[model samples]
Target: MAAPLTDAGEFESWLNDRLDSLEVDREVYGVYILGILQEEESDEEKEDALQGILSAFLDEDTMEDVCKQIIKQWTECCSRSAAKRDAEDAEVQAIASMIEKQAQIVVKQKEVSEESKKRKEALLAQYANVTDEEDEAEEEEQTSGNNFTGNDKSLFKNTNVEEVLNRQKQKRDQAREDAQKKKEMDKMQREKDKLAKQDRKEKEKKRTQKGERKR
Candidate 1:
């Protein structure tokens, strides 16, 4: 068996800070101790033994239930000693005080939770604004700048608007301007060749006429 609780102070300390999983067992243990005090145990001895047998457990409401049962049994079965009454009274007061402190702690925890929630909401709102700005920038780049969406790339089979425009420029130069320039250069070279042929024919005709006169 586990060692018994040795002090009245130990009960209240456990009630304030110990795990709640054992609460039912502790309350049931309190009931068992009450049942055993029906015999002629000294009030002092009973209180001390009760402490050693049961750790402090239960909330204020449940504690009041256990205290009522213990007080009633002590009065009826044991001697109605003043010291025992005083001691039980002090124990009841201490339990009440611990309950009040727990209530205050709960209120403080709620306030802190609300503060954390507010901060989280503020952070989310700020992040949403930043995300909106980035989305706008991307949309503008898609419409006007040299960028392409995945759908745009697949649909057009091109990277960006700039590439499309540059390809169109090259097509225009090849189809109209470059062809016209080649035609003009050909016409000039043909005219120059014709003029040289005409000059040579005229000079040959003049030389033939002079030779005939000399003969």
Candidate 2:
């Protein structure tokens, strides 16, 4: 009997963490991905494939890409295998149905994992804005420095620090979001410039080659 498929989230994290180690070969890693998805694969084959995958996973990006690829193939395999077979088979039919359900479960797990990842990144990115607000609040308090004077209970009665801080926070958060937007725009521009430069170089090289042939 083939082994059951592994959890997508756990497998994804495991691969990505290994990629952080900086020694995995992409070709070998690809093979390992295939090997792992082949349930009922022999123990020897599994160990050999894992050894390669374990070697160096320095590219989180690559791992993520491979995660999708693996899941895609695994789902297909499960679906194809799940087709009802003939010849004496309540148990067999049940097993096939279970594999089909497992395929659906794995796909859902992938969706949930991607959503959770986006939420985590958004929270982390927003953390800088929270820090910015705290710093601003501290600076305001420092600069204001005890101007209230002689207010045992008569000089001031309408002070809402919470409301003020919240307003300030809202402004700071908006500013931070705007800055992030600009930064992404700038990064995209840089990539475009890089691509244009490469294209220009390729054209120049082709023109030089053509001229040399004529000479």
Model 2 misplaced regions, further than 4 Å: 1-159
For model 1, what is the alpha-carbon lDDT of residue 208?
100
Q: How high a TM-score does candidate 2 get?
A: 0.27
Q: Which ten contiguous residues of candidate 2 have the minimum total lDDT?
A: 79-88
TM-score per candidate, in order? 0.31, 0.27
Candidate 1, residue 153: how far the Cα is off, in Å: 20
Show pairs that collide, candidate 1. 5-52
True-structure Cα RMSD, model 1: 19.7
Q: Which ten residues in a row have the lowest lDDT in candidate 1?
A: 1-10
| Residue 65 alpha-carbon offset, candidate 2, angstroms | 99
* Number of the top-ranking candidate, with TM-score as the measure: 1
lDDT of each: 0.63, 0.65
